[model samples]
Target: MGLVNKTRITDNLAVIIGNQHIDVIATEDFPFDVQIRFIKTDDAQLDDGSGKKVFTPEYQMAFAAAYKGKSAFFSNTEDIKSFTKQLKEIKELFEFATLNKQTWFDTASFDGVLSQKVGSL
Candidate 1:
Protein backbone atom coordinates (compact mmCIF):
# COMPACT_ATOMS: atom_id res chain seq x y z
CA MET A 1 0.00 0.00 0.00
CA GLY A 2 1.19 3.44 -0.83
CA LEU A 3 -0.10 7.00 -0.69
CA VAL A 4 -1.77 7.19 -4.01
CA ASN A 5 -2.63 10.72 -5.12
CA LYS A 6 -6.30 10.87 -5.88
CA THR A 7 -8.99 13.47 -6.58
CA ARG A 8 -10.29 15.88 -3.99
CA ILE A 9 -14.01 15.84 -3.29
CA THR A 10 -14.83 19.09 -1.49
CA ASP A 11 -11.60 21.03 -1.77
CA ASN A 12 -11.10 19.81 1.78
CA LEU A 13 -7.94 18.21 3.14
CA ALA A 14 -7.21 14.65 2.10
CA VAL A 15 -4.42 12.28 3.03
CA ILE A 16 -3.67 8.74 1.89
CA ILE A 17 -2.40 6.43 4.56
CA GLY A 18 -1.49 2.95 3.52
CA ASN A 19 -4.44 1.69 1.47
CA GLN A 20 -6.99 3.88 3.21
CA HIS A 21 -8.18 7.21 1.91
CA ILE A 22 -9.01 9.66 4.70
CA ASP A 23 -10.53 13.06 3.91
CA VAL A 24 -11.24 15.93 6.17
CA ILE A 25 -14.95 16.45 6.70
CA ALA A 26 -14.56 19.35 9.12
CA THR A 27 -11.93 21.53 10.69
CA GLU A 28 -11.61 23.13 14.06
CA ASP A 29 -11.16 26.90 13.98
CA PHE A 30 -7.44 26.21 14.35
CA PRO A 31 -6.67 25.56 10.68
CA PHE A 32 -4.90 22.21 10.79
CA ASP A 33 -5.83 18.86 9.27
CA VAL A 34 -7.56 16.49 11.68
CA GLN A 35 -5.92 13.42 10.19
CA ILE A 36 -2.59 14.95 11.12
CA ARG A 37 -4.12 15.82 14.44
CA PHE A 38 -5.04 12.19 14.97
CA ILE A 39 -1.53 11.01 14.13
CA LYS A 40 -0.20 13.51 16.60
CA THR A 41 -2.78 12.47 19.18
CA ASP A 42 -1.34 8.98 19.17
CA ASP A 43 2.03 10.37 20.10
CA ALA A 44 0.57 12.56 22.81
CA GLN A 45 -1.67 10.06 24.55
CA LEU A 46 0.68 7.08 24.38
CA ASP A 47 -2.08 4.88 25.69
CA ASP A 48 -5.29 3.47 24.29
CA GLY A 49 -8.32 3.86 26.48
CA SER A 50 -11.46 1.80 26.49
CA GLY A 51 -14.41 4.13 26.84
CA LYS A 52 -17.22 5.78 25.03
CA LYS A 53 -16.47 8.32 22.33
CA VAL A 54 -12.71 7.93 21.95
CA PHE A 55 -10.31 5.98 19.76
CA THR A 56 -8.79 2.92 21.37
CA PRO A 57 -5.02 2.63 21.78
CA GLU A 58 -4.79 -0.40 19.56
CA TYR A 59 -6.35 1.76 16.87
CA GLN A 60 -3.71 4.39 17.44
CA MET A 61 -1.01 1.74 17.27
CA ALA A 62 -2.17 0.54 13.88
CA PHE A 63 -1.88 3.97 12.33
CA ALA A 64 1.27 4.74 14.20
CA ALA A 65 2.82 1.52 12.99
CA ALA A 66 1.79 2.29 9.48
CA TYR A 67 2.96 5.88 9.67
CA LYS A 68 6.31 4.71 10.96
CA GLY A 69 6.88 3.13 7.55
CA LYS A 70 5.30 -0.25 8.00
CA SER A 71 3.87 -1.51 4.75
CA ALA A 72 0.09 -1.31 4.46
CA PHE A 73 0.14 -4.86 3.22
CA PHE A 74 -0.69 -7.27 5.95
CA SER A 75 0.93 -10.65 5.42
CA ASN A 76 0.00 -12.43 8.61
CA THR A 77 -3.27 -13.49 10.13
CA GLU A 78 -2.64 -11.33 13.21
CA ASP A 79 -1.84 -8.40 10.97
CA ILE A 80 -5.17 -8.75 9.24
CA LYS A 81 -6.94 -8.88 12.55
CA SER A 82 -5.14 -5.78 13.68
CA PHE A 83 -5.95 -3.99 10.48
CA THR A 84 -9.64 -4.81 10.77
CA LYS A 85 -9.70 -3.59 14.35
CA GLN A 86 -8.05 -0.37 13.30
CA LEU A 87 -10.72 0.22 10.69
CA LYS A 88 -13.47 -0.43 13.18
CA GLU A 89 -11.94 2.15 15.46
CA ILE A 90 -11.80 4.64 12.61
CA LYS A 91 -15.44 4.05 11.67
CA GLU A 92 -16.42 4.74 15.25
CA LEU A 93 -14.31 7.90 15.30
CA PHE A 94 -16.08 9.13 12.21
CA GLU A 95 -19.27 9.38 14.22
CA PHE A 96 -17.55 12.15 16.10
CA ALA A 97 -16.75 13.79 12.78
CA THR A 98 -20.38 13.47 11.75
CA LEU A 99 -21.72 15.31 14.81
CA ASN A 100 -20.47 18.56 13.30
CA LYS A 101 -22.18 17.79 10.00
CA GLN A 102 -18.68 17.21 8.79
CA THR A 103 -16.95 14.11 7.58
CA TRP A 104 -13.43 12.87 7.55
CA PHE A 105 -13.80 12.60 3.81
CA ASP A 106 -15.62 14.29 0.98
CA THR A 107 -18.08 12.31 -1.08
CA ALA A 108 -16.12 12.26 -4.31
CA SER A 109 -12.84 11.30 -2.69
CA PHE A 110 -14.64 8.64 -0.73
CA ASP A 111 -16.32 7.44 -3.86
CA GLY A 112 -13.02 7.35 -5.64
CA VAL A 113 -11.48 5.21 -2.93
CA LEU A 114 -14.54 3.04 -2.77
CA SER A 115 -14.41 2.75 -6.52
CA GLN A 116 -10.76 1.71 -6.43
CA LYS A 117 -11.57 -1.44 -4.42
CA VAL A 118 -9.37 -0.51 -1.51
CA GLY A 119 -11.19 -1.80 1.50
CA SER A 120 -10.93 -3.52 4.87
CA LEU A 121 -11.25 -7.27 4.75
Candidate 2:
Protein backbone atom coordinates (compact mmCIF):
# COMPACT_ATOMS: atom_id res chain seq x y z
CA MET A 1 0.00 0.00 0.00
CA GLY A 2 0.93 3.64 -0.46
CA LEU A 3 1.08 6.52 1.92
CA VAL A 4 -2.15 8.09 3.06
CA ASN A 5 -2.99 11.73 3.72
CA LYS A 6 0.01 12.95 1.79
CA THR A 7 0.69 16.64 2.24
CA ARG A 8 2.92 18.94 0.24
CA ILE A 9 5.39 21.09 2.14
CA THR A 10 6.96 22.82 -0.88
CA ASP A 11 7.32 22.58 -4.61
CA ASN A 12 10.31 20.38 -4.02
CA LEU A 13 9.25 18.86 -0.73
CA ALA A 14 6.46 16.85 0.88
CA VAL A 15 5.35 15.33 4.18
CA ILE A 16 4.16 11.79 3.93
CA ILE A 17 3.78 9.19 6.66
CA GLY A 18 3.36 11.87 9.28
CA ASN A 19 0.98 12.26 12.22
CA GLN A 20 0.23 8.54 12.28
CA HIS A 21 3.33 6.89 10.89
CA ILE A 22 6.97 7.85 10.61
CA ASP A 23 7.54 11.45 9.63
CA VAL A 24 8.93 11.33 6.11
CA ILE A 25 9.84 14.55 4.38
CA ALA A 26 11.31 14.61 0.90
CA THR A 27 13.11 17.06 -1.37
CA GLU A 28 13.78 16.87 -5.09
CA ASP A 29 15.49 18.74 -7.93
CA PHE A 30 18.26 19.95 -5.67
CA PRO A 31 21.96 20.16 -6.51
CA PHE A 32 22.17 16.47 -5.79
CA ASP A 33 19.83 13.65 -6.76
CA VAL A 34 16.48 13.30 -5.00
CA GLN A 35 16.97 13.59 -1.27
CA ILE A 36 14.55 12.37 1.41
CA ARG A 37 14.67 12.78 5.16
CA PHE A 38 12.80 10.53 7.54
CA ILE A 39 11.80 11.53 11.05
CA LYS A 40 10.37 9.52 13.90
CA THR A 41 7.47 11.30 15.55
CA ASP A 42 5.51 8.65 17.38
CA ASP A 43 6.52 6.85 20.52
CA ALA A 44 9.04 4.11 19.87
CA GLN A 45 7.09 1.53 21.82
CA LEU A 46 3.44 0.73 22.20
CA ASP A 47 1.61 1.15 25.50
CA ASP A 48 0.73 -2.54 25.74
CA GLY A 49 4.39 -3.47 26.29
CA SER A 50 4.46 -5.57 23.17
CA GLY A 51 7.63 -5.50 21.10
CA LYS A 52 5.82 -5.45 17.78
CA LYS A 53 6.73 -2.59 15.49
CA VAL A 54 4.28 0.11 14.59
CA PHE A 55 2.88 0.44 11.12
CA THR A 56 4.64 2.97 8.97
CA PRO A 57 3.72 2.97 5.32
CA GLU A 58 6.57 3.39 2.92
CA TYR A 59 6.26 5.37 -0.30
CA GLN A 60 8.56 6.55 -3.06
CA MET A 61 8.99 10.11 -4.31
CA ALA A 62 10.57 11.03 -7.60
CA PHE A 63 12.67 13.89 -9.05
CA ALA A 64 14.62 14.75 -12.18
CA ALA A 65 18.21 15.99 -12.49
CA ALA A 66 20.93 15.94 -15.07
CA TYR A 67 23.40 13.14 -14.80
CA LYS A 68 27.01 14.22 -14.64
CA GLY A 69 30.16 12.60 -15.98
CA LYS A 70 29.87 9.52 -18.19
CA SER A 71 26.44 8.55 -16.85
CA ALA A 72 24.71 11.33 -18.81
CA PHE A 73 24.54 9.36 -22.02
CA PHE A 74 22.96 6.35 -20.31
CA SER A 75 19.97 8.24 -18.94
CA ASN A 76 16.52 6.76 -19.56
CA THR A 77 13.57 8.86 -20.68
CA GLU A 78 11.02 7.03 -18.52
CA ASP A 79 13.10 7.55 -15.43
CA ILE A 80 13.47 11.21 -16.19
CA LYS A 81 9.73 11.64 -16.61
CA SER A 82 9.05 9.89 -13.31
CA PHE A 83 11.62 12.02 -11.58
CA THR A 84 10.18 15.22 -13.02
CA LYS A 85 6.79 14.30 -11.65
CA GLN A 86 8.23 13.77 -8.20
CA LEU A 87 10.10 17.05 -8.36
CA LYS A 88 6.92 18.87 -9.30
CA GLU A 89 5.16 17.36 -6.29
CA ILE A 90 7.92 18.57 -4.02
CA LYS A 91 7.69 22.06 -5.48
CA GLU A 92 3.98 22.05 -4.78
CA LEU A 93 4.72 21.26 -1.18
CA PHE A 94 7.03 24.24 -0.95
CA GLU A 95 4.37 26.49 -2.37
CA PHE A 96 1.97 25.19 0.23
CA ALA A 97 4.42 26.05 2.98
CA THR A 98 4.87 29.58 1.68
CA LEU A 99 1.15 30.10 1.46
CA ASN A 100 0.77 28.97 5.06
CA LYS A 101 3.55 31.34 6.19
CA GLN A 102 5.62 28.46 7.52
CA THR A 103 9.37 28.21 7.90
CA TRP A 104 11.15 25.61 5.85
CA PHE A 105 13.95 25.18 8.33
CA ASP A 106 13.18 23.02 11.33
CA THR A 107 16.64 23.51 12.85
CA ALA A 108 18.62 26.60 13.83
CA SER A 109 21.54 25.59 11.68
CA PHE A 110 19.68 26.26 8.42
CA ASP A 111 17.66 29.22 9.64
CA GLY A 112 20.00 31.81 8.17
CA VAL A 113 20.16 30.14 4.81
CA LEU A 114 16.39 29.61 4.70
CA SER A 115 15.73 33.23 5.57
CA GLN A 116 17.86 34.43 2.70
CA LYS A 117 16.12 32.11 0.27
CA VAL A 118 12.61 32.89 1.50
CA GLY A 119 12.42 35.87 -0.79
CA SER A 120 13.00 33.69 -3.82
CA LEU A 121 9.96 31.61 -2.98
| CA-lDDT, candidates in order | 0.34, 0.39
Q: How high a TM-score does candidate 1 get? A: 0.27
Count of clashing pairs, candidate 2: 15
How many Å off is the CA of 103 in candidate 1? 14
* Candidate closest to the true structure, highest TM-score: 2
TM-scores, one per candidate: 0.27, 0.32
Clash counts for all predictions: 3, 15
**C-alpha lDDT (0 to 100) for residue 10 of candidate 2:** 51
Candidate 1 lDDT by residue in tens digits, 1-121: 4554442322332344323344443323212224422221222233346544333221111121123233467789997886566555445443433342213333212221111111121
Global lDDT of model 2: 0.39
